[model samples]
Target: MKYNKKAMTKLINQHRELHDELKKIKVEMGLEKNLAIKTLFHSMVADNGPYMKEYQELERMQ
Candidate 1:
């Protein structure tokens, strides 16, 4: 299916917003200031960072 430019722009913006929110959540969980949270986030990023496309696709459907 072809999406119009405006729809694509909106989807991109939504994806960015989700990413920023996740970053904020990670920071607020003390990941940036605590060792354990940092380790968890690091491991998660290493193992699943590339799966964000699935999350983005799901988010777009909402």
Candidate 2:
């Protein structure tokens, strides 16, 4: 299937924005020293890591 370039670019940009927000949250959690929440967050990120890498590859291709 064909994809719309502009739409895909916008989608990726939004994905990057969301990822940045996640990083910000990580810092906030670290500051709070919330061990349990930090452990859960790390697990969630690890599970999603593959998909995140794929998106990054796509961005590089563009």
Candidate 3:
């Protein structure tokens, strides 16, 4: 399947932005004692980081 380069670039950028925001939120919420929220955000940050990396790699290969 072929992808539009412009659209892929935009998608990668959006993913990058979301990954960054999630990291920031995780840091800002560091002092919170809510284990559930912290765990959820931690997982989200972890997942997003890898996904963004994969997306960037795919974009580069395009």
TM-score of each: 0.28, 0.27, 0.28
lDDT score for candidate 1 against the true structure: 0.43
Put down candidate 1 lDDT per residue, 1-62, tens digits, no spaces.
Answer: 22233433343345665346446656766554234323433433234554334434544675
Candidate 1 error regions (>4 Å): 1-14, 31-62
Best of the two (2, 3) by TM-score: 3
Write down the RMSD of all candidates, one decimal each: 10.8, 10.6, 10.8
Better of 1 and 3 by lDDT: 3
Candidate 2 residues 1-62, lDDT tens each?
Answer: 12334433344355665446445666866643244334333443234643345444555666
- Per-residue lDDT, model 2, residue 58, is 56
Higher-ranked by lDDT: 1 or 2? 2
Q: For model 1, which pairs clash? A: none
Q: Sort by TM-score, best first: what order?
A: 1, 3, 2
| lDDT agreement of model 3 with the native | 0.47
Give each model's clash number. Answer: 0, 0, 0
